[model samples]
Target: MNSTLWIVRVVLAVVFLASGTAMLTLSRARMIARLGAWIEAVPIGAVRLLGALEVLAAIGLVVPPLVGIAPMLAAAAASGVFLVMVGAIVLHAREREYLQVVMNLALAAMAVFATWGQLAS
Candidate 1:
């Protein structure tokens, strides 16, 4: 179980780090513009803030664990991802993007489980 949790943590850390970096840097304005169409009700600044938070969480997921000082930071970061996934599901649902909602929910579940496993251990 420990090994499995470690693997899950590493995979999720890598994925979120890459994704968050992309969100922060890769055509960020364009990506925010795309999201704007679906969530016109939301402020673009808020979305950008969320992107920044994701990047911070991604760093949190890897740094502390790797450094051996505060493994709980990794779990906390996983929790942040879980929260982001919840927001994603809600946004997708509002946009009637049912498939995306499902996918985000699944990812949220995995994050939650991994977070709990890490924290518990």
Candidate 2:
């Protein structure tokens, strides 16, 4: 169970980190080309905010627990990831991007399970 949770956390962290970094670094046109119309649906400020949160959450998911201090932060970060994915699902659904919604759902489920397993442990 612990191993499973670690695996999930690492995967989530890697994904979020890459996504957040892209959002932070990419221009609107670049993002639009890569991510489709959903980038235009939200304000640039909101995108930056979400990107910041994701990057922080990614770091939070790994650092505290790995360093053996404030391990509860790992669970908290997992929960944060779940919430972020929930928002992603909402945005993707609103944009009629069903495929993105499904992907978000899977990631959200993994985030939830990771949080649950960590909290239980």
Candidate 3:
């Protein structure tokens, strides 16, 4: 169970880090090109805010637990990511991006599992 949670944490951290970094660094045109029309609908500042939150949440998911600080923060961070996934699902669904919605659902489930497992332990 611990091993599985660790794997999930690492995988999710990597994914969110990469995704956040891209959002932070990329120009609107590039983001739109890579992410599709969704980027066009959201304000640039809002997009940047989302990027910052994602990066922070990614760090939160790993650091506190690894360093033996507030380890329970990992569960909180997972819950935060779960909220983000919920938002993603809503936006994707509104846009009729069923594929993205499916991806969000999978990620959201992982987030829930990570949080639940960690808190239970």
Candidate 4:
């Protein structure tokens, strides 16, 4: 279970880090434009900020655990990802993008599981 949880943490951390960086830097304009049409929501600046937060969380997930400096950071980072997914679900729902909502929910569940496992161990 510990090994499985570690693998999940690494995979999720890499994914979230890469995706968040892309969203923050490369895809900011496109994302904001698409999301803007819905609720004038998620300003460009806010998107960038969120992206930064994700990157930080991604680092938290991987670094502390591997370095043996408070493994709790890993769980906290997973929790942050879960919170971000929650926001994503809400944003997608408001946009009437049901597919995205489902995807976000799935990601949130995975994050929650990872968090639970890390904290448990």
- Give the alpha carbon lDDT tens digit for every residue of 1-121 in model 4: 9788878788888878876686676664566555444334656677678879988988988899899999898899999999999988888898888987887888898899989998888
| TM-scores for candidates 1 onward, in order | 0.80, 0.96, 0.96, 0.85
- The list of candidate 3 runs beyond 4 A from truth reads none
lDDT of 2 at 105: 98
Q: What ranking of all candidate models by TM-score puts the best one first?
A: 3, 2, 4, 1
lDDT of 2 by residue, 1-121 (tens): 7788888889999999988887899998988887678999889999888889989999999898889899999899999999989888998998999999999999999999989987898
Q: 2-52, model 1: which lDDT tens digit per residue? A: 777777777776766665665566454666454434435556566557768
Q: For model 4, what is the alpha-carbon lDDT of residue 38?
A: 34
What tens digits encode model 3's per-residue C-alpha lDDT throughout 1-121?
Answer: 9999999998889988887887899999998887767887799999999999889989989998899999899999999999999999999999999999999999999999989988998
RMSD (Cα, Å) of candidate 2? 0.9
C-alpha lDDT values of all predictions:
0.75, 0.90, 0.90, 0.81
| Model 1 misplacement above 4 A | 26-29, 32-41
The top-ranked prediction according to lDDT is: 3
* Span of 10 residues, lowest total lDDT, candidate 2: 28-37
List the RMSD of every prediction in angstroms: 2.6, 0.9, 0.9, 2.5
Query: In order, how many clashes per candidate?
Result: 0, 0, 0, 0
Clashing residue pairs for model 2: none
